[model samples]
Target: MAGFWLGPRAAMRGYRLFGYDSIGSTSSEAMASARRGDAGDVWFAALQQTEGRGRRGRVWESPSGNLAASLLIVHEGDAASVATLGFVAGIALQEALSGNLPASALRIGVDGADGLTGQGHAARLALKWPNDVIADGGKLAGILLEAQGLPDGRMAIVIGFGVNIVAAPTGLPYPATCLHALGTPVSAEAVFAALADAWVDAFELWAGGRGVADVLARWRRHAAGLGSEVAISHDGQVVRGIFETIDEFGRLIVRDGARGTIAITAGDVHFGATATSGRT
Candidate 1:
């Protein structure tokens, strides 16, 4: 087992650690650990994943040299607390990465015509609310939080994280970008080290009665969709609106005039320019 840290400040806070060299899917492995009743902060990490997964049952491209890991946290709080996992993970990862580089230089997105950075005065890396990390309009990392219904009227959540460290796969469902594309090289060990610390910090906040509102605020600070016109597709219906806030329950609030303000709990949100008319 390789080394893992709870945080830069705190030691392991009641978490039992599990590390692996390689696995089929970190999410699957973490969920298994939860099922066995060993459910503190368990992390499943591997140098390579043979069969990784993403949202909507999509297969994640988990080639070698990327970060494929998942954290299984047993629900001890309410449903809202459980749902904040994704937002927490996103914030954690962002904090971890920011510590390594200048905030502006670390921002993820496309280089302009003259390869100049955008006009955000404060160094900003936007997020695709709920579960995506974007820098400059391209995908930096994707997150999927799955809950397994236990027999005893309980559920275990597995937070799966796929980050492009060395490379991002081409010809995928959505246009993929990696840290390398931005001239930054991320190592697996370094990524894991920062992630572990960030997770502990995020969960601690949730445990302290911060609620989803706090998560929403942090997410919006780094979100890619705020104030932008976008389309959200779910169950064959499409709604286009100016991206708005996420409510306390973690639902997206979209203002589309005719539809008023629609709360989107689940859907594929496509930003404009790259926006699709509907789901593929």
Candidate 2:
């Protein structure tokens, strides 16, 4: 795994990586490194996490076989663009896993849509609003973006992701699944390797949000429940409406019966009939 990142392809792009058998959390470690003025393009991976968490401080269960990884970038772009990187990460992750999964395990939509009609290989994977990946109508992966100002007058953006490669957590608020359960049992190491390369490509495509239109279009192509009824919880209130489209700036656009179009920047989204417990 180290050799893959240290090779010319990754080294030329200034990629550095570290791995741990067990750690508190990959995101926490990356944030600490950034505060110490470490150069960016660093990837941290852990076999297990003792203090892992997801959106809104929800517990993130990282067992022995799942993929817990985070990437730190010293960003100098606008805050809006930096926030959009979460979407970029989501797209990269979906593309990476799709390439590695078997063809038989890939399908366009949860309703059995044909593959060729969607976004090529990415068709099988769906990007649930802000930064969640869905497979087989269940949660497959989650992304969390944490940012803080650096002393050098730049922003440190840590993009953390947890993928269910070997197993998924049980007794969650909503349906959870893993690659193994979906007929594509892969190792955490393999997923991390693919993710690193995919991230580089995705970052280049994002071009510091200059190409956000393209990114948003690609994400919408694989978005789940875009035209279906869904609910979003924010600030202790729940807004139930039709899932419209994501705006140009990466906010969730919902069409409410009384309020017309509403853009939600942060919230816990729930689809039809799904139990709403925490943010996905």
Worst 10 residues of 1 by lDDT: 108-117
Write model 2 residue lDDT over 160-217, tens digit each, in one string.
Answer: 9999987889997666778888888677888888888888888888998898888887
Candidate 1 lDDT, 1-280, residue by residue in tens: 5443444532456654556666799998898887888654677776578899888888888777778878887775656667777888888877776565445555333321011124545344556766876655566678899887776767788988888777787886556666666666767767777888888877777663465567666766666656667777778887788777777777888897887888889887787554534444
Candidate 1: TM-score?
0.86
Q: What lDDT is reached at residue 107 by model 2? A: 47
Over 4 Å off, model 2: 1-9, 105-123, 275-280
* lDDT on C-alpha atoms for all candidate structures: 0.70, 0.80
- Tell me, by lDDT, which candidate is best: 2
Global lDDT of model 1: 0.70
Reference-based TM-score of each model = 0.86, 0.89
Residue 13 lDDT (model 1): 66
